[model samples]
Target: MSHASEVPASTPTIVVTGAGSGIGRAATRLLLAQGWNVVLAGRTEASLLETAQEHSRALVVTADVSDPEAVQQVFLAAQSHFGSVDVLFNNAGIFGPSVAIDELTPQQWDEVCRINLTGAINAARAAFAHFKVHGGGRIINNGSISAQTPRVNSVAYTVTKHGIAGLTKCLELDGRPYRIRATQLDIGNTASDLLNDFGATQGALQPNGERMVEPTFPLQQAAEAIAYIAGVPLSASVNQLTITAGGMPHIGRG
Candidate 1:
């Protein structure tokens, strides 16, 4: 009669990108609290450290996901510190300043595409390779409600999110034979800094050129949903999950 605590240190190791704030931070905490070792990857050491405070199993790696070499080092650091990487919460992303498609500069579009779409691809590739070496692993990508529906004045951001959905589906198919499982969480209107700022500022912009504050729920709800996906047996992974505010327009609104 041995409990999970008996071999807790042998629990799965997870890598979390964008671990500095918001959803990444919340997911890292939830994973660590569940006795999983987490590698914190972010450009900011201070914020990553803050998320990993006083946790011995947490390893902090400063990384910008858009850089190929930097992305490699993050996984290398994970292997170096934790012996192996069993899961990757590929959550690094940014909502570039909203602007109409006609006004969005080429550079602006490139930057968002590089970080949001290319970045997720890089992390997933690294995770897939690592999983092949280690026998198996899980990848949970942080997609957005934008994947299903474009947002007002969010041309660049919405396009990148749609790319993430396509990537997630491809990974699910490509990784199956190698014991690598991929899942996408299409999140919306969680009470994070980004959503809160939206609530305070532009609120919700309707397709008909109106604005209203969309409802929001606790960040923990999304984090916990991720944990649930990660906790399931590898043979039974959740391919896609959408968690959003109860009253969000994602359900129906012009």
Candidate 2:
């Protein structure tokens, strides 16, 4: 319970990372529709532009979240365009190579850690710094149910998402004094480009000589959930939220 009521609204300024695709893109569209001045940051300019084109209210910027310099520029541009950012959708992440840890390459591990974990750290750091000075802001990290339940071939992804849960908790504690609210969404399978990219999802060979991909939830459902979280006032914050596909086997997952 920090001094969140101190600032008057002139339309909330928000920054969303990984805005080029998936949940990020969907969330961006919702925010723009609500008239929030949103800055879209991601590695791909083409995708960013395409996302922005769908909504005239979006400010598109190409940024590699893995780089600190690039993140700084993103912040500067957001502040320059919108004055102050009231919330950060820290959603950039990479679901690393699906393989056993023993078979996973060091390079692959590094890439996942860099994007999913370290990249989150960088974004949170920059956003917190700005928020602290501006009195307070909200942070929402895109976590995965994998953090709680491990997937056999997704070691790196699980590890990074676990780190994200820790990140969210620590930030929630540290940010309380500054009126900065932090939360994480531990999402289960949702319809997105990431799922479509899994080559064997339709049916891939497994140890049992069978391939199985879990059913996916509609992307719109996840998008709506995210928007609801974002729309919550500073007085009340959702510390953590987990929304998954109704029929998904996450409850029984190892």
Candidate 3:
């Protein structure tokens, strides 16, 4: 609950994509409370402003991460306002249609890839450019449990998440000389608007083809994990971290 003391003497600035709601919103609030300046980026200006909550340190930047130019603008705006950016939270993503592979449309797959995979790549590239000049920076990618295991009828979402894992590894390897650290948080069943829409609150589809309600943890926990990783010094790095609801059927066979 308390991370203010862990923060460096100088205020750190972080750019969080998908800051409009869910984990991004939660992490932004916590980061602000911990004395970090955050630039909120997403497709909706209104939601990003809402997430800002009139915080003096929060800058709202409306951007669709799928656009490389827009993603570059998010970092540029952050630098213009905050002077510098210390971390990039690549969290903007969409869970495409949930249907069998044969039933899935090509457009649906492309949409998910554009946002989930390509979007993260764009942000990472921009951040890497900034970090090289600024000395060092961190990137915390919001990967999903689907990165490691796939659920029934979740081809698009799962594939993009797996792609994110690969992206994370590439960043880590490629950014070492420049002090750019990358970490992927593969979270599971965190309560969010997306989860509710996916029917987790009622019952989610199981791999066994059955529907069952799954336990979900609060958004604060996931946010806290992100904050912890963000606060770590560049001298050390957390390559990957997995946080999940204890009752979620991810650790073992359901």
Candidate 4:
């Protein structure tokens, strides 16, 4: 971690969890390019370093968002390196075992809740505390489309995402007086490694028990949307923003 003295005080800083790949990595790269100090926090140190790519404004911190202590450490490291953290991209999550409700084990459910829901809450708690003291900040959560709708054999993932939606609302209500803003970015299919199972040729499982290929947009577009929200001022808050492929069957998803 670089010392706070090394970075200019005026530079805006954002902490991005799960910054190793996919949307998190894309957003981090774009933020760094746009002259923001970024703190890359993820489970894999090597992957976080790769995301940082030796950027002078990037600080790599390895952390599993499920662990509250580790998540707190991420904020501390960010503040120590950049003087203050202005935003937190709460984007760490995982799709648990794809099994029906009856077939899903308790351990599997607990594991998913621990990371997807608990992890997000932990990060938000830390960010809220920091923001309250520093005047204000923004939190952009990667809620995913599952936050509003469910897919077959995705009970664990779906439930946690719904929890994220609730968390976002609570943060918004609670942070109003402190200038802390919260936004939930629900994204649909995007072109990334995580979508390999639901690729154009592979096809994803549909609500009616059939499989169909779903349309997807570029990863860069999703990244740009996040950047736009993060750039919004505290006086104005984007409570919720949903982005999906034009041809994606989300609006009328069964």
Candidate 5:
């Protein structure tokens, strides 16, 4: 019988940004469990360590993706540890706040742009460069429901995710010759174990200025979706995927 996970002769190593927590951490775990090597990267060493602890196939790198230098170092460390990089999950992001666009500060906007958009750019560039040499690789950008429709007080996040959608298309076009394929996973609310303990979830503002608790799916489901995308042989590709809670207000706006 053919194995479900037929790891290629060349060891598959994936670099996951924002790997210290939330979706990144969940995806990293699923990837690792599926016989692929993983490089856990984020701003916090302690969290990365916890994610990679006792995992022989895991490499932990403390990287703040917004810093170009730091981002470069992450790929370098991954290449050094695993010999080559096969996939990069462009998944690091933050939700700044829910406020009126006029009330949003310049610093807040810049901060979100730097980490959400610029960070993905740096990582995508690095991965493309590496894939160019290695003949190809995959990059899965973590987009959001906001990418498709704007939510109140989410200017920075919405803008950056729309930027990600653009970036994914660009990569898909430019990387075709080299076998570098790109995909975007536009996810909705995902329940995080870490956040659940703290009761961190709150009402999300609707387009009509209504605040309501957003529906959420298990974080693992998103991780598995990512793994499925990453696992497909290079011959095939999933260009874009949107996985949101069944009742999330994404398909139609209020």
Candidate 6:
């Protein structure tokens, strides 16, 4: 068979959290371009609408993933718009305060956990339930390389990302009977507002003062990688994937 014919043409209905910006935005655009209907979810309604307006198959829904009720509403809206959710890209997360653990405030700690770890759980809960009823789906989480080797002064973000690894594994096993697949993509510095903000807050400069954070990634590269993982056949699956910048310190424990 030709390579073109080898790829599946199943137009999946995809739900992407944190779709207002960054990797989520890239994923949404890529999926839409590939002829999939994407439901974009994020806290910013205006940005979400802007993303939706650009794509004929986009359905924008604004909701905070940390709030269970809001997450439910978002999913319901997605289902209503797309008939069924074939995949959920659980990308909504916060980097939290880039303070040393000792200096990190209780509020900052809680908020990060709420958005980073709990948000994934809540969205997965909703998505898994829907998949169970609707006959199966895929859940792809946006994990960080820091999940395994953390950066200094980013305890909360690191901890939550580590939790995501466990979550991905657990869900993968549990969803087997339903044919639902769960995977984690351990990302290393891709150019985005998150990295920009992280640099602003944490000083992305080394002691010698080299600038961190490239202006932008070939966003299409990472998005296409994820699109491939999400579009895999039910009989086979990509349980975990990692995509990172070539010069990123993510490969090492740095």
Which candidate has the highest TM-score of all? 4
Please report the candidate that would top lDDT against the real structure.
Answer: 4
Cα-based TM-score, every candidate: 0.93, 0.91, 0.95, 0.96, 0.91, 0.89
What is the alpha-carbon lDDT for the whole of candidate 2?
0.82
Pairing residues by index, what is the TM-score of model 3?
Answer: 0.95
Model 2 vs. true fold: TM = 0.91
- What are the per-residue Cα lDDT tens digits for candidate 5 across 145-166? 7789876666777888999999
Candidate 2, residues 1-254, lDDT tens digits: the string is: 00011222377878899988899988888887877877899988888877777454577778888898888888888777667898899999888787889999999999999999989998999999999999998999999888888765788999999999999999999999998999899888788877644433474234454566667887778888878888888888899999987766676562
> Given candidate 4, what's the lDDT at residue 186?
96
TM-score of 6: 0.89
Tell me how many residue pairs clash in candidate 4. 0
Task: Supply candidate 5's per-residue lDDT for 130.
Answer: 95
Q: What is each predicted model's overall lDDT from 0 to 1?
A: 0.83, 0.82, 0.88, 0.89, 0.83, 0.81
lDDT of 4 by residue, 172-219 (tens): 999999999999999988776667634433787888888888888988
In model 6, what are the clashing residue pairs, if there are any?
Answer: none
Worst lDDT run of 10 residues, candidate 4, spans: 1-10
Question: Which pairs clash inside model 5?
Answer: none
Q: How are the candidates ranked when ordered by lDDT, highest leading?
A: 4, 3, 1, 5, 2, 6
Give lDDT tens digits, candidate 3, residues 1-254: 00111223267899999999999999999999998988888988878888888887888888888899988888877777678899999999888887889988988888989999889999999999999999999999999998998877788899999999999999999999999999999999898987865677798888787898999999999999999999999999899999999878885426
Which lDDT value does model 4 have at 237?
95
Of candidates 5 and 1, the better by TM-score: 1
Higher lDDT: candidate 3 or 5?
A: 3
Candidate 3 versus truth, CA RMSD in Å, comes to 4.2
Q: Is candidate 2 or candidate 3 better by TM-score?
A: 3
